[model samples]
Target: MSAEIMPYVVAGAMAGGFINGLAGFGTALFALGFFLVVLPPFQAVAMLVVLSVITGLQGLWIVRAAIRQNTRRLARFLLPGLAGIPIGVMILSVIDASTLKIVVASMLLLYGGYFTLRARLPRFERATPFWDMLVGFLGGILGGAASLSGALPMMWCTLRPWPKQETRAVLQPFNVAVLAVTTILLALKGAYTRETLIYLAIAIPAALLAAQIGITVFKRLSDTAFRRLLILMTFVSGLVLMLRAVL
Candidate 1:
């Protein structure tokens, strides 16, 4: 890579890492933009999955106890999400990814905008294993098709009043699992060449350090604030998503 490209790589790593550490998801969504500027689409995505999973391990550790305590709940989201991945991959053959991203981003914008204007956050206190699974399944499909696995879950989890750690436990591991599968598939196709490994070496440390900073900020937020942060992120992410698709 040229020296001109180095800044964008570092910027993407830091951006993706910080978001992953703070929110337990969205590394690819935030990082991919910077990467796509200088890297091929396939190479950007290949590196993204790796960076996402590697940095996401820190998030998993942050909520390790909550994860253990809520394994069953996590499964409700994860197993379905995993099942949907191949289908999502299949969808890519028949559908236009930019169109899908635009549609979803529009929904996110509206959802985040409408809720932000309301005084109270929407709360769903009832146990809804069915809904959780559905969200996870759809999220997986999106992840597979558009590398957007976290979007649906991020929307759904904000409706619940789970503590920050508990929410991270779900979002963090779900993303890691989905992206891990992607990483494997990409590896099988030989996406990781020597050049890619060189970029990974440059990216991993930048991401790890940035993520640690995001974790510090995450630890300081109250439950309500954290939920609000997710809500705000949904809006920002949607805007960014739309721009990426359109541009």
Candidate 2:
């Protein structure tokens, strides 16, 4: 990466790490918007996958206790997500990158809009394994395609009758597993180059530092406040994704 481009990349990493730290998701949405400005789509997605793993690890540590207690429940969501990943990886190899970005952006916009109007919308009942697996499958496809596996699960958790901590417990680990798979697939595809390593050297530290700051902010917010913030950020992320595609 050029010296001039490094700053934007670091800024994006920090912003992404912060959001992921706070809400346990959205690292790609927040980071890729800035990265897409300076990097090609493949390179940017590769970098975000690496950073997503870093952020996911950090987030897991923050919520370790909840994860331990709910491991069984989480497995219901993760197993099918694992099954769906290879299909998503195949899509990534074959699909037009620009078209994928537009599709992802449109999904984000619709997801955000739905949540913004959630109060007016009818409430969903408790989550069933069928729905969990369905969303997890979709999330895996998106994750493999664009490092966006978390969005659907995040939105799903909000609609379900879960508390904030439980929501984090499930999605954080799920993201870690999916992104870990993404990284391996990218490596198999030889997406990582010398430049990618250099970018990671810069990104990892920025991401870790910002994640801590976000965790601090998350600790301070009430459950109600956190949910509202999550909704707003989702909407903002969608707008950013769409703008990146157009401009």
Best by lDDT: 1
Runs with alpha carbons beyond 4 Å of true place in candidate 2: 91-104, 117-127, 245-247
Top candidate, metric TM-score = 1
lDDT (tens digit, per residue) of candidate 2 on 154-189: 777766655567778898899889888878978999
Predicted candidate 2: what Cα RMSD to the true structure?
A: 2.6
Q: After superposition, how far is residue 197 of candidate 1 from its true place, in Å?
A: 0.2
Residue-level lDDT of model 1, residues 68-143, one tens digit each, is 9999999999999999999999999999999999999998998888777778998889999999999999999998
lDDT of 2 at 140: 82
TM-score of 2: 0.86
lDDT (0-100) at residue 228 of candidate 2?
67
Alpha-carbon lDDT, every model: 0.93, 0.81
